[model samples]
Target: LNFQLLRVMEEWQQQLGEQHYVAMANDLLMNLDLPGQVSSLTDIGPELLVQLFEAICCDCRVGMIRPAVTQADLRHNLACVIDSLANDVLHVSLSHIRPADLMSGNYEAIRNLLEIFHGLMEFLVGRSAGGDGGDVTAETQLEENENLNGRLTDQLDRIAGQAAEINELAKRLAELRQADRPLPQTPLPATAAAAAVDAEAAPNGDTSDEGIVQ
Candidate 1:
């Protein structure tokens, strides 16, 4: 971390405050693909990246995004931010942020955030789907997201595997058909020996093998 980024982050921390991190996180989360999410308000510097992340999460937390916001709905949003940072945000290129890096950074904090989202999401899913189980509501979001994400992931894998199998079977069928069909047969021409024998045996034929000899 450079002094420039440090100063920028400090400024953001002061300006946005920790209470508003969720909203900040939310905005940054949505605008990963946009060019001027927060770099417009905050000065452009090395910590520019950190500033953006903080602005996103924190801004979304307490700022203007509340009415339509939910802490439990942020993984995909976070993933989107992470993807933008790793991929490039708003046409602003980032060196290379591995998704694993996001996973490892502040796992506890991230987990806590995810847990909040998970609970919130579960509530929404159940409420929307009309499922009932009062005790299951606490960590319902995490359980649901994990299960659904896993099932969808598995379904994709199965579909890919099936396509490969069908392709292989089609290739084999073509080969078997080529091998099973009978090959063309060429007829042998009549031999000279049979003609000679028939001439020799004729009642008026030349004696011995002289006639056939020529």
Candidate 2:
């Protein structure tokens, strides 16, 4: 079953999770880029959010150089480490804001965010090309990731507000029904369940229906 592969996947997913949550937190932080202290994780801006999401999805390759880990495992682990460091960037951004004047893509904020990802990936390419680790700089060039369409918190807020309002309306409906109803004298079949629940029910009730609304 390639348990190691599975573990590697699990680790990668966790790295994604950490990066996912943390980067969103950064976007929510000192939104305007503070000077030296970490901005709130929630203050990270739109552009940073997109870049972080791209870093999460992008595949990173790291070479096997007599390490205890295999190429795939090492790649997965290194990808995870890169993600972890990206979160570290967000963590640092909470308190430290790189100045636009000094921000030339070589600073620690940039390093903390991107260096390891490109460096290790390139290191893999070099080893493949010539069988040795190549010189990789502590600086990396970050291309802005274009896929993260909207801020995570904004999405969450919209979903949550819709859910709350919908659920509240459902509650009001249920109260109205109760006031008008006589308890069914005969226990109805499971088929008689309230509309929403029945439509969404599995034996375990794990349905993707409007329950999120109700």
Candidate 3:
């Protein structure tokens, strides 16, 4: 198990970059009294196993290793890690592997545990990175949608105001046209028309009579 863990650490260092790996190792060493090298799987203790599990499963920094993995993939890989250790090394069925059982000072128990941890670390890294990116993207898209909706609402208001003004102008123009139209003339009575004709001819008839008398 120590040999497997060493290999896993070496591969992780290569993937994570030497500088970053060194920094992470320094931090882990500060918290725990772990040796610089692993002599045997029997030398590993429960504390180290717990620390390793926390580092790989719960630490945020592990995400830097892979950034594109999805949640489903992470879950699947974690399940496989547990199943592999349970079936091959422990020869038992396990829904989840406890840190205590990982390094109980027993060679068989510790065997392949670190290997499973290594695999689980890869998936954890992907999950962390992908979750952060997904959150940021979702927030950005939401903000953009809000901005677009605001713009659409403003345009609709402007169009509505313009339409209202057009309607009012049409109404006023109709009123003005109605005011300019000629009033209808009523027809005179037949008796009134005859009286008006005689009045107009009376002066002409009197002048003719005066001419004849002279």
Candidate 4:
């Protein structure tokens, strides 16, 4: 499913080129679901949400390139998408599943969010390194860099925090599942339970079904 989206993005990049693709992506981001429900996504299933996240990441990366989008616009969209996935999706959906039934795909959503943000951060770093700060005064460039850095740091923190939360939740779930599990069955009492208990407890206890000593 992820492969298909990547292929589509690659084909689009080939057909539209980076600049136009980025523009289209920015527009798409503006319209895509922002306050989407993680619960709702689960109802339909994770595959759709996974694809949506991947598509957003791919487009946002293209849009962040030179001559496509302003840093402000890119950052705003990134924030919205990340917030939606984190608050509306990962955190919310984690509450719904049983620990014994933890799905790998749920964690995949977190990975997808991290992947997108990391890619964007890398693009930002590359852009900064390559003098995308040009045409601005030194003070302005410094402030812009600071703002971008802050946004990236806040997002990385959010993603990292979410990852930790998921880990803890998984552990807790395992504990709960283990605790809730039924104990191994014991042999049933023969005749009266009190007599069975006495027979089992005697010094020469031999309550075998084949030879129950009186």
Candidate 5:
């Protein structure tokens, strides 16, 4: 299966140009964290097979390959890859793969599935290179651009929402600070008892002792 996958990739390199092939390969290996030099797909371990398939599925989903590739097609191809890896390479049971009952162990089935995958790859690469009577039409390119624009618009909307939330939080914080400020202190009026004492001491508008008995 690895050999087959490698052959498909090499064909892609030849047909799609080294730059395009390298870009696809790098995308697959982006976060795999594989050790040493991985000069080919065969260098990838059985455990990482799912990741490789997932990357390819993503490419298909995003219209990176051919617009004709549908979700069902991706699903089928993915099942094929998983089936081949689980049964042949890893020698594991189908339960290990999601939708365990997807495919049963059979040499014939495996071969057929691999051939299908190869054909699918060929179709993808051929379409990308404007061959196989399936050149990327203007409509497909427009659809891809619209999809990309939609993603960018969603991101921008999310960013704008976050920015608005931050601004609102900042405004609330400033209002809280204003509300927490200490108010200026005001002098209190004199007590009633103190006022009475002053009035008594100044009786008849005089503070002198002229009316006091000797």
Candidate 6:
């Protein structure tokens, strides 16, 4: 998938020039499409979504995006991805009757969802730290700018907070799964007495250890 993205990027840079190519990339990142395909992260499934995000981040970092893709676009796309994932997490979390069941339910899919958000956040923070738009001026007046920025900030903050809430719930559920799971009687990597100990420990005959075991 990344190889294909690279090839497309090369072709785009050659034909459309760096500026337009950057704009195109921004559209893909924002709208989650690639040329003729509807290749959004949600559309790609869990396995490929992370790879696609990695490719997008790489493009943002060193793909020579200039004169078209602005820092604002980068930030906007990151925010969009974050917001989208947050909504997904909230939906799944809210819809489920038992949050702990998430481990046996849609756990893998939910984890993948969070992973994408984390990846985007890492890229966004890294790009922001590079002073990508440091020279860009905020020409708005203080009062009006503060009002507008405050509203935008509030929206992003709400999304981020929702994502964080989902993340915390996921973590708690995962830990619940782990804690409820029976511990191995024999530890892995046997010591000098390896010949005597069985690597596969017997499952606990005690059922109480399993809490809401699915």
Candidate that beats the other on lDDT, 5 or 6, i.e. the better one: 5
- State each model's CA lDDT, in order: 0.41, 0.38, 0.45, 0.44, 0.43, 0.39
lDDT of 5 by residue, 17-77 (tens): 3343334344445533433334443333332333455443443332222332554544455
The TM-score of candidate 4 is 0.31
Q: List the candidate 3 regions with Cα displacement exceeding 4 Å.
A: 1-35, 59-104, 127-132, 136-214
Which portions of model 4 miss their true places by more than 4 Å?
A: 1-28, 31-134, 180-214
lDDT (tens digit, per residue) of candidate 4 on 79-155: 44555544543333223222212123343343334344344445445556878545868897677656655665565
TM-score of each: 0.24, 0.20, 0.27, 0.31, 0.25, 0.26
Which consecutive 10 residues in model 2 have the weakest lDDT in total? 141-150
Better of 1 and 6 by TM-score: 6
Arrange candidates by lDDT, descending: 3, 4, 5, 1, 6, 2
Best by lDDT: 3
1-214: candidate 6 lDDT, tens digit per residue: 2333444544543344334323433444454443333222223332233334544444433232223255454434433334433353222222221222222324333333433344444444444675655454665234433553444445445545654655655555456456654333435433424433322333546434223212
lDDT of 1 by residue, 138-206 (tens): 587567656655543453454346446545555555564556643223233244666666686778845
Clashes of each: 22, 27, 0, 0, 0, 0
For model 2, residues 1-214, the per-residue Cα lDDT tens digits are 2334444554553354345445434432333232333333334332443244334434433232233344344334434444443353222222222223113332224323333223333333443575345554433212111111123223334434644654555565556466765444536534345654656564575555543334
Q: Residue 43, candidate 4: how far off, in angstroms?
A: 13
Using TM-score, give the best candidate's number.
Answer: 4
**Candidate 5 runs further than 4 Å off:** 1-134, 182-214
